[model samples]
Target: MRTRSLTSAAVSAALGAALLAAPAYAADGVPPGQNPAATETTNVTAGSTPTADTPTGVPSGVPSDAPSATATPSESPAGDPSPDPSSSAPAEGTGAPVFGNVGSDPSDAGFLTVAVSSDSAITEVSAKLTQRHGAEPATVAVSGFTLVSGTPLDGVWRSPRMSQLPSFGSYDVTVSARDSDGDDTSASGVTTVDVEPKPVFADRSISPAVLDVEHTHVKLSGRISLFDPISGETSPLGGKELGVSAQYGYSAVTAADGSYAIDVAPRLNGENATSVAVSLSFWIANPDGTNTYVLVDSKTLPVVISPSRIRLDHSSVRIKYGVKASSSGVVEYLYGGTWRPAKGVAVDMGYYAKATSSAAGRFTLTYPYLLSGDTSFTVGTSLDSYLDDPYLTASHAQFKVDVINRTSICFCTSWLDAYSDLHIQGSMNGSDGKVPPNRKLYLQQSADGKSGWKSLGWFTVKSNGTFNLDAYVSVPKGYWRLYSAGSSDYQPGNSNSVHFNRTATRITGFNAGPEPVRKGRTVTTTGTVQKLSGTKWAAFGKQRVYILFQAKGKKSWTQLGSVKTDTHGHFTARFTAKQDGTWVGVYLASGSYVDAESYRDYVDVR
Candidate 1:
């Protein structure tokens, strides 16, 4: 029985190869663990593999503790370099077990894997997992290594995983092997559960989700729970900095109970008040540099300025944008209820009035294009979904600022899929607040805007300014916009664009084990759909996953069957191999995620 570390100086001196920090990887396509005591360079004679039942002595660079991802594996200062295992005389006449790769899988978080091979019949192999937390230290056993291929003594082992670790530190791992002859030998190594502090926040709401632009700052307060939701582990984030930001930023302190409040200033992208999108991001940050809140909610918000901040003299084409701001470009002013960027693809603006502020909070639009003369005035609108400034609230108001001879058409959209017609609806209005009779609105779609828009269907404006039409849309996978080519006096126009994104999930770690399975024997196929949960791969469970197999004679991959992932985000299926081929899993996009294909797992059936 002996234990030692593997130092670069020693490995290089013996093997003549650069002995860098080589981390042994595990499952999810990572090779199984390796025996620490096993020499990197072997001198066994010929094809007849041989082994020693006992250690020659301790070797170089065995750390006193387990290896950590954050901490480099360092050699013990007291460790004395010794000759390679080949130089030591065997302590026993019986051939020892030749251990295979023994390492931990980074994806699995805190699991170590060991595969062993031996010259003699292997009776048993054991792995010890040690965790030290302050004065209290604990240990556990890694299980599920199935012997595949060759004799039981000289077989390949895979699919070994570790249990939930008790602490957040390094794990010392030691693997021992006993042969049928009752001879024993062991290999020692260390691994760690040093994962980044994962932050998962619970939902919280502000006192008033809506506000007025006149208010410089609005109170944004919420309760948060920092923890690994899937792991059911609570993360203590008592004193981390939390912030909400858009064009501007604000900060707050997380209370001991995960509560925090900050006054955030909402900065709109335009001059006249419009609905602004605001987000509270990285509300909490971990010491490991991990943060949460990937997709912040840009809910219904309006930062619209009342009394129509934009004074437009249509005859002279003079536009004065006035808003009270410490600086210009601080808030986006909107003349129309919605602010449509003038530079969108194939965008034909009948009337566009939107600008940010200047140092004096005054904006004058001298742009020659604003005078196209189609409407009396424009209302301010949100740039995207919500306002970034806390002071801004949500508004949808159409106003007239000047007396001008004008013809205009404006509309909104809605989807009705539950019915057979697949009907889409919209309401059009003019500057006079009257519905124009016999107006025509066409539905056009574009996969990419560069390719000219294609008309799908047309809707005749109703007497009430409403239009209804049903278009056979299989999936709303592309952008759809309403098109008005313009009637006698009205100008050509396109409505706001809409894109329905198909959600998708990603799959990884598709593995078929008992690597070398015999023909006609069933091998366990295990895998995971590696979904990101606050920067770490968390198991997405209770979802339908398809098992696909492609054999030599098969023309295409056929669905063998399906399986659901466990709470731990793992799925397993068993199949008897008739011949050698490949196995794969297809995870159909569930709610929130789109469809994904797992990495191909090749099964070698002998």
Candidate 2:
């Protein structure tokens, strides 16, 4: 703590109700485990009046017996003044000040008064306090004096706090006045101020000088200063009957060492106080049993409580590629005490993702949930921003994500078994390490060398990342492939290409029966049409085959009889062997497939 020092002699005097004698803050210069710079001299000296005019710096409208306010530097001193202390007489004409009877000054007692001048012409009037004890005289200002009602003469001067002087000495005082033209005169009061040391609080302190509004009590500790002016001795005023009051309701009594504790419930601060300074003024009860109080020293303590914010790691992304982090951080703010976790604080995901704060104010968030085909996305918001916490204000954070397209391979068989049902199988995944489950996979076909891929059919993807489609090859194409129409969390993809080409129908067996037949005799022909699946020829059923006959010397052959293959794919035809030389069986080509012919087997007739 710092003290207010007076330059020259120090005298003891108090102003009216303002406690003008209230001392400037003082220090023993050392506290428990701490050292401070030199303290200022707490001295207040009485006046040696100004020759030109009283130093007009006092604030206006004081208690009775103080000076009537003269013109301030801003207001002209031409019209307002008290003509007589007894009546409400306004002054006339701008003129020099007049002086009257001089009263006793500081040397005689602690209080003094005088008769001075006031008129329409007077600008500013005051009593200036000057000390003459040292080599050079120094002045200390004592303001807020009230004019005595008896008569208007000289204005009295006093300090606002009524604190006692820092040092003991005699003080000479006088009255002075000035007019608009700056002319002035001064007269000395007969009385002089006699100052003496008074006991007070020398070493005092408040624990945790800075505090939170929630603090319920303050710890006050101190030892009173005891000095005897007559005996020239000093001691501690222990076991004193001192007391501290808060707003005249709550108070605490001093212990043996003058230490005390004060309850601070419902803190004495403004409504919106984040940080505030409150004065704890010290006083003691009068020993006269009159229940009156006497002034002491005052110490100011600062009391506080501040809002929260979130810091983000990543701020942008793309949807087709799949985003990595929706939120890379957490909400940090003032809570139980200093800044720490705003744990469990929910962060809003505006069509992007979900998030919540954890330890050390951290949160994890993933993106693109149930939101597809987004060109631009602003999401992962910190709804904590709307909390509007007074100690920690609200803040928000977000990330931007987008969607795009990519290339993927669809799996299909190189050779299609037209006999069996045509089925395609494949898998789906993304670059961001996302293997989407329970998704749809489509089978598509394209023209030989051109045209867009048309979807044939679709199937659901299994948990193992694979999917299959069993579909009939109804509308065949030269090339085929698979597709994945992306979901909200993944991008669209494709599979490797393929084609649908039916294999040729083969002849497994063929025979011409009834060797050496006579004319008009019936001859039977038989054959089997088959398809190779793996290493075995499987029957090609439900198809027609032909038995042909050619005359011995003719190139063209005639169709003797037509027969359809049975379940085993075997066909037989009977015809009259009319001058027949040899017979052959033929199979025809159908949609997107080649045909097969049987080897000639000769049968002769006579």
Candidate 3:
């Protein structure tokens, strides 16, 4: 092989000294010409005459400079710039040595290259294999290649250029050729074409850290970059897949430019505060049997769920009533697509109990269990459903009456009559103690079974216990029961029922007056009246007939007349209304008979 090395010059110097010491000669022992071996460029032609520089008795008996007598110019020819005494021909070798540029096997031959691009496109390939085998110089075989491994080689198997194999890996190429004896030889070489895996965006994030439990809406935004191990450039991660998920299994994808965003909301079933982390991954493969995947190289974002801002207030105009709750733990209602506080608002003691000072708008809700009317309240909190397991809700809270009753009265009088006045006062109490102030009180009483129970009046309780009532009656002679009705300040249904009786001494009958007569028309009115006897109507009994009457345009009237009556000596009348307006008539017992109070009358006219 006509090869050149850095040490070739020194070897030439030593060759000259050997040539001077020994006489160059053939086996014939003749003197060999000492002219430095001249390199002759020859177009050696078979059967042609040798050139002038051709030497006799050389190997193959063909001079080294004889190109006209050599194979065609297309054939590979050896060259020698100089010859010394040390230069000698082979000692009659046996047969031609194996000499083609290729691998060990005929089937193992091809080419390997690499691909590089700004966006995953192949860019360049290796300069064809320049290594040599024996005297024949090797080349990136363009044809006649076979694959002992990797891609199969055919008549025209193509080499993997720098572009085709964009990923990193090892590539094998084989080239085969045939010698004069018709023996096929092949050679293969490995090339490493590595294409790095770029970075991909995993997910996005939001500012202000955690998402509070009461927080409904949140803003989403973040950045992404290619995670290339080989280079730190921000390469495009187009067509890549990404995911973002939270405690409730919420997830999102990235854009072509590696940017990603997502909105985290409460699950269909509401929850508590939570913190979530985002992640990313990238994958790539190479021709040399190598692969890679990067984790979180681009960017890591976080999602925070803040607590919900729940405001509970009294739904009723009157704040004196109790409220009812719908749910338990982490109670919430859907408001404007987000979770809010439950209805029937009430003070949450668990929250207020915390040492953290409550803000101005902060208030507690006291749910009504037994009180009348609608009332409730709510407060603001900072917590997310995700972080905490069983979130704060109606079920988790304990509800009780907010306002306690404190004012009540209980008094017993020694002397009581129609002419005497009575005064009574006191304060109310709860299971604990005297209830809070500002509550109202009421008084109720039932007259001797005749008038029944009736509400006297309502009054506000003052710091001092003082209240008065006039006990004057037209005919005072009966029993009475007194009590109070409940309110925000007072509990309905009195705890105790008080009773009292008046002296019995009534035995006088009024005059049997004339019946009412119309203005211009004559109307006859007659009746039998009763006499009050010892707190009872004794003269008013069976066997008596009485006519009661009232004048037109009058609210009060009396018994007109009476007769010895019914089964004994009964009486009747013919009455007429001379004018329009209202009137009343009654027929009662005039003689001795008990409980005869049935005949009552009423009349109206236009």
Writing each residue's lDDT as its tens digit, candidate 3 over 443-535 gives 555554445666666665455433444443333333333344554654453422333333211112222223333345544433343433443
Which residues of candidate 3, in runs, are more than 4 Å off?
Answer: 1-240, 245-250, 254-259, 262-277, 282-402, 406-481, 485-606
lDDT of 2 by residue, 298-408 (tens): 445554543566777767665454234354676776646677766655665554466667756677766534233344433333343442232334466656656553434
Residue 199 lDDT in candidate 1: 34
TM-score of each: 0.27, 0.24, 0.30
Error of 2 at 45 (Å): 22
Error of 3 at 379 (Å): 8.0
Candidate 2: clashing residue pairs, number = 51
Where in model 2 is the C-alpha error above 4 Å? 1-202, 205-275, 281-311, 317-326, 329-398, 401-606
All-Cα superposition RMSD per candidate: 36.9, 28.8, 27.1
lDDT of 1 at 515: 73
Q: What's model 3's TM-score? A: 0.30
Which structure is stronger by lDDT: 1 or 2? 2
Q: What would you estimate as the lDDT of candidate 2? A: 0.47
User: Candidate 2, after superposition: displacement of residue 499 in Å?
Assistant: 28
| Higher-lDDT candidate of 2 and 3 | 2
